[model samples]
Target: MKALIVDDEQPVIVSVKLLVDWKKYGIDTILETTSAADVPALIRTEKPELVISDVQMPGLSGLQLIAMIHEIHPPAQIIMISGYSKYDYMRSALQQKCIDYILKPLDEDQLNAAVGKAIETYRVEASQALIEQSYDFLHSELSKKRAQRLFLLYHTSHQTSVIWAQLCEIMPAFSSMESCRIGILPTGHLPSELFSGARDLSLIVNFIHDLCYETGQSIASEEPIDRNIHILFHSELSNIPELCRRIVDAVREEFHLFLPLGLSPAAPFPVNFSDAVRQAEDAVQTCGLMYTRQPVCFSHVTGKEAETPPVFRMEEQLYTAVLNGHPSGIRIAVRLCLSDLTSGKGLTLRQLLLFRTAYIGLRMRWIESFRMNHKTAASLDAPPGSYFRLPFRDDGQYDLSVMEESLIADLSAISDYLKGVLGMGPASQNLFQQIEQYIHFHYAKHLSLESIAEEFSLSSNYLSRSFKKKTGSGITDYINNVRIQKAKELLENPEIKIFHIAAQVGYSDEKYFSRVFKKTVGMSPLQYRIAHTAILPPLDLM
Candidate 1:
């Protein structure tokens, strides 16, 4: 990609520059020095892949230059130019591993041929290096996955000794480990779109693995579930706090996100791995309320065990509202439940997440009963395992306002659908209006026709047909229109980055967002921002 030329003659340098087309060989940067003494410093700074030098120079001879280049960057390719064609000179050049030896009064064709060959050689070596790197990465990932599977089997199977033997086969270090602590790290309430793809998930996992390796602590085992990674570490490794700090800092620096890590008390290795995992999970939930990008240990949590009676009461109220088809009561019940959870002492994000899960389950049960009684063909969609991702503010504290808004929207959609089914609400147009409101509220989420239909307990075909007939547009078109409109509003703020805007508006890929924006608004996001944005004059500090 880059080349350096060393010679004491300026005209020769100009002639050599004119003789060959550097760009043709993929050398975009060319460095030239008339003094051989300057070549070493240039090599250090520029890191050229190819070098061409004259045999006779003021300070260093061509042989000395070639040796120095090899010492500094062994992979660099060199071509030697000499006025004399003596056998000794050519032989010495070849001995120092120069790619080619050429007599001066340069032949343009000979120079081009040598340069082409050197470029090709460099490309081949680079490709080989990349292939080796990819192989190593895949090998590492396979080992981690295998270890995770063994861990799961060890927990579930009655034959623990057999699973432990297999785990030891894959990770020999585990056999020698005496005691260990488990740490659960959750990718805290960043946009779900950030981890929706497999590549992003692998990136985060690999980053943690590499970081753990750097600290001289090999992960004994790791399990990834619901945006969380459970990492097991040897108890003797006392640098876990420092390691967690480094991990959090690196993740924040690299992904502009927060990662909360929770640690458990030391337990006997292999035997107590399951209990350690549960303790670590509890630690994460306990500390998540006051999390500030630091590792929280189980021993550090100070609170009485959470009371379940109030949560159960609220659940009953919510079920009653849903069964009675009281849309307003559903919103009221949800708000009250959230209030009770947050107001309780020792309240945890885990509690809120579990409450969300329980609510969905109850709603499904009610829907099933309704279907059985009426002999309707409707069934509730399968709920996501982790639905309520506790939203956070920029300061890394919980954002209850946004969470409440999203909760209200989600529950209201279900209530509206039930209301329609019971024939207690207004016409079909009213149901479409409720659907529009739900789309506006949750446009940033991964929304689809099937997902929306599932939420409302309707078949996808029926929902699609009814929505189009009532709204005069397809459900997908309406979602995209909402997203594009939201994107336009976000683009108005010059401070927000385009990619962040893309994620906020339900499009994970920035380029795809731009294409959709252009198709809808007749201009790319940047152009539209520039056209609509008013230029502000500089602030006077003087």
Candidate 2:
């Protein structure tokens, strides 16, 4: 942005100019007007995006100039640089929408932040103006300026043309240039272990913008997401893998802010745009949980277990593992299955998608299982732990939502898939089978402790204790586990209402069943199956 320095003392203007590395902030020309008397005319001609001025001047004090300039350009952002201690001056400046007032003998870091904040405001307003909007008029000259004021709304559409126009308007040196890629940097909620404070993050954010600007890439947005600073940049250089590593190093050395950054794998296809954002978001999610410390791509942000499973079958088993509260089992099972596919070498893109699908599905199922009240429910339902899932469709081939929907439509089918039908063998070879059968056969048949003990030739107390010991749960727990599982089966069938799902699962109340479902699944049972069952196979075929 073109910035104007307005102060009475030429030496202060020169000192401020010398201290600032303008090129590093993509500033081409630093306009100078030492007296506020010259500002109204200079401002009318220059139309600078930002103004750095002293509060006290020989004539037309900064406050007066601000009022006059604002009368012509209400959207202009000004930051008062002052030595004055008067609260009245500060109050007046602040009320006039002075972006920031930096105390003199200035802090370089503070000055940079004030400047960055001012430019950020400009970019956001400009970005918004360049985007979609309708205009209004009152049939007067005032309406013309008001229409111009409509640009105050900020947005992101990856609009290079808008930024290009902005670069021309502000700098003019690169008005005709092209071939820049806008990178939205990760902003907000970084791991506390890495960054010491908000001040530290802010400094780091400023340094990043400086780096990107120096490197011919400009920082776009400073908005926070997940847990890190967000910036946008467009670059001319290649070997971004190495470029990304340097960025992490700069954050560490420049401002003592350690940040785990996710650089989006360059989107080769237009269709991959949304996926690129997911990759960036996924990187933050990993760092927020402190799962990884190195700069990374989203696919590798998690550990080897996160490497997507090879085929649909193994993926389904691992998903069930998540539901069963066996994270280790899911990891190991995934490793074994992936090893079979890749011989433990590494994952191809298709395998990665399948792996992600399995992981999300398992996590989603654990969510669904939580909503039921089977004695087995607590044992079977759990979370995806540190990893959050973001699955989206880029084309017809990437339809996980549809697959999840279909899977929910046939919960029993998914259950069978989990049971290893057509893959591992019959469900009888498992310990879960014993629990599953016991619940199914005994659920509505006076299956309480007393009768089960009599049938098993043991005392009621003894049998209950044994059941709890064997399953890490009580007999009541086991019964409820079965009921909830059955309830899920009934809930998945469109033929049955939730009320019946409750009754069939051995509860007479649908309201109670819904409460249980919401607890486990993080959604209603109906929503769970619908979200998950509408699965689309991997997106590689096309």
Best by TM-score: 1
lDDT of 1: 0.72
Q: Sum up the clashes in candidate 2.
A: 48
Please report, as a residue range, the 10-residue window in candidate 2 with the lowest summed lDDT.
146-155
Per-residue lDDT over 201-228 for candidate 2, one digit per residue giving the tens place of the 0 to 100 score: 5556556655654544434334443444
The parts of candidate 1 lying over 4 Å away from their true place are 1-3, 10-31, 83-90, 100-176, 186-228, 236-238, 246-259, 293-297, 313-340, 353-542
**RMSD, one per candidate, in order:** 25.3, 21.7
Model 1 reaches what TM-score against the true structure?
A: 0.56
How good is model 2 by TM-score?
0.33
What lDDT score is found at residue 540 in candidate 1? 27
Q: Per-residue lDDT tens digits of candidate 1, residues 1-542?
A: 88888888888889888998887998888889997778888888888999988888887887888889988887789998888988988998899788899888899999999899888877888789889989999987686677666765765564288887887777776678888888877654455566645437567776776666544445523343456766767788877777767777786677655667888888997778778878887788776465663445555456534446344667556654554445577678768977776775655666666665665666565555444433343444432232344456543456777666666666666555555553335534355655665576568899999988876667999999999998899999999998998888887777777888899989888888888889989988888877777953123200
Provide the TM-score for each candidate, comma-separated.
0.56, 0.33
User: Candidate 2: where is the Cα deviation over 4 Å?
Assistant: 1-168, 183-203, 215-217, 220-245, 252-361, 375-434, 437-542
